[model samples]
Target: MNNENSKLTISRIIQAPRSTVWKAWSEKEHFEKWWIPEPITCKVVKMDMTPGGGFETLMSENGEEFQPHVEGCFLEIVPLERIVFTTVLTEGWKPNDPWLSMTAIITMEDASSGTKYTAEALHKNPEDSNKHLEMGFEEGWGTTIDQLEKLIMKLA
Candidate 1:
């Protein structure tokens, strides 16, 4: 479900087990592999899966020179079920003005087909939501999810 007021959402039924999908997300090494749209690369700088813990990554096109991607903190973590993170704060609950501010909620659940993965990006206002949509949120997020499923399939 998506909210036109200030949220954009996407969900998919990943044809893999929840544990495996969670492993791909919880492990930084595995996370770095599919966190971004490929051809471009992602480098996981830090991922501490706890309340007030940091989650940061750098991205690059050439694989050498990297640029800042996401520098944020995890607001909540429910083991393999859900994770809430916000870009408005850094690790340890420190305030930071990000280029774009958003809090993301990611949920994974068991499904008959596989794992039901949902991602919701919550913005402070519709203007920000529009900005993200204009920036190709659907395609970008969808691609990464596809990459994730592909990575899991490959590794399996």
Candidate 2:
């Protein structure tokens, strides 16, 4: 990958099957549970898991107020295998202005213990990529993934 278009990849092995993880990701109710860090509630406004479909969410510290956290479009979806989303476009392929446009590719693979999950955030430019890193992408993402693991484990 070129440095100009920086990409950050994070992966984990969850003690669950790909179907379980995919269910958590594909279902609105299940997704919101671990999509964000604790203390911050996540509301799934819209989720159409198909190419050119919409994916929107709101997050709020207090239940009273909710603000837009993610407004993106699904570029690709392979059941139980992979998902690709981008913030550059909204539902219906409408373009949107974002502080930093990026495409996120999430994949799931079978593992000896369970499932190997990976998330890759690809930025348009190095500056934006560095900005995400500076904004604690690793910590935030890792925490959310951990939360996901816990949820899956409990449900398992």
Candidate 3:
């Protein structure tokens, strides 16, 4: 694992195939099912799983008032391998002034009996990285990943 001054990495070995995990991310319905933690529902406003494509989503506690959770662009996409996205740009590569500019790299590799999933959230500065850490990045991401595993396992 590479450690950076402005980056956070979380990894786990999910007991599912790489393709299954990829499907959970690529499919809008599947993604929405586990993108957010329990009690918080996710609504995919727009999602294009391609480079420079939009990846927008909303989250709501009660299913009425959906608040913007992610408004970003896909930086890279490799089927069943990796996904990279950034909040510095919107769909079609349009620049956006975000409170904090960050890129997330999600990778999946074949494991002995499942898939090795990893996510690295990289920030432009240490302050922003620390802020995210303080904002429960680990707990939030961990819970989402756990939900993803459950969803995939059920589908499998």
Candidate 4:
């Protein structure tokens, strides 16, 4: 159930229960523990997990902070199953460019004694998708998922 041309999608099978993985994503405290890699701390500036709510995260590594990534309103949220939110990077959700917004859909499914996590990012055009790929998205996202797996396993 994936299309290569339908934006960007990353899938992983995490060895954890659905509830635990869902909590790791929905809870801000649990989210910070695995959202970034080692030596880099991730903090949620603001997270309101609901439709029309904005979520912001700040990534700091070696005491140096990179520009925070902000996602604007959630278009859809299905508890323990899926989250569809719009990605808009701006201070306090205000779009400076007014032309950069992507729809990100994260889905969770029950697998064989584990959970399937799928992150699908729908960009406005092919250029945006190419940009994400050029940004070492595979390695970056793989590391994030690896971090998540380690954290969730500790909980289990």
Candidate 5:
């Protein structure tokens, strides 16, 4: 992994508590509800909320189904404060190899009446970073986040 040239980070202040935000991510049902953008549906194949556990989510876009994009094991889970995971060679805690891997760090902190959430994705290289950027990283991630905000607010 060429860490020096690859990074994608986004932070948003959600109008909800840290617990709410954490539940939105840690719960399969809640995650599926907001993990995809409009016109795209996501199915959580499996989610084991523990370090070394695994997760996968299938996405269908515009009537076309795509294979799971994320197959990773959790590295850390710190309740409402942070979550760390990696998309490396693994399936339900089993190891294997395919494409590039990434470590995603999600942090949550109290912010007045809500929560300040930050997502930082570290990629393998500048090329991979550029590839993700070209794949609508801003729009896609932004929309998913918007969906999360809406879902949390609705439940709040």
Candidate 6:
């Protein structure tokens, strides 16, 4: 898929350093707290960040049953800098056709104020990209990023 129509991205300057942001994304404890917007909980099922490792999570609104959130494979992990994962493949590079498929690229860079965090979700086609956008891709991801910044504020 081409970059112009088959992708959605969010870029924001957070008040924390890249190290802090990296920890929030890398560490399980910090990740769970802000990965999914709160009230709705996000549980890390597997977080092996190495290439070809599994990256999965479960989400629940209540205290009881949890539903599958994302089942993806880590395509690349550049410590404190970048992370690339795809729903097109599971762990060990196994193929899987997920209900909603996309590859997410997360980047952290040292900015003047703090970290410039960017997230991009790339779909295989324009239709898939539009579907994700119609599903509130911006609002949902923006809310999570806001939550993350708040969490970092508390930590700082």
Give candidate 3's total backbone clashes: 0
Clashes of 5: 0
Residue pairs with backbone atoms closer than 3 Å in model 6 (clashes): none
The CA root-mean-square deviation of candidate 5, after full C-alpha superposition on the true structure, stands at: 2.1
Candidate 1's residue-wise lDDT over 1-156, tens digit each? 245679999999999888889899999989999999999999988899999999999999999999999999999998889989999999999998999999999999999999999999999899999999999999999999999999999766
lDDT against the true structure, per candidate, is 0.94, 0.93, 0.94, 0.78, 0.82, 0.94
Candidate 2 local lDDT, 98-145, one digit each (tens): 766899999999999999999999998788899999998999999999
Q: Write the per-residue lDDT of candidate 4 for residues 1-156, one digit (tens) a residue.
A: 233554878899999988988988899999988887767888888777777677777778765665565546666789999988776643344553434457789999999969999988787777777787777767777888899888899888
Output the number of the TM-score-best candidate.
Answer: 6
In model 6, where do residues sit more than 4 Å from their true spots?
A: none
TM-score of 5: 0.89
Between which residue pairs do clashes occur in model 3?
Answer: none
Write the residue-wise lDDT of candidate 5 on 31-147 in tens digits: 988887877888888688788887777888854676676778788889999998888745455665536567788899999969998888888788988888788878888888999
Worst 10 contiguous positions by lDDT, candidate 4: 89-98
Question: In candidate 6, how many Å is residue 116 off?
Answer: 0.3
Estimated TM-score per prediction?
0.96, 0.96, 0.96, 0.85, 0.89, 0.97
Model 3 gets an lDDT of 0.94
Q: Kindly give the number of clashing pairs for every candidate.
A: 0, 0, 0, 0, 0, 0
Model 1 local distance difference test score = 0.94
Candidate 4 TM-score to native? 0.85
Off by over 4 Å in 2: 1-5
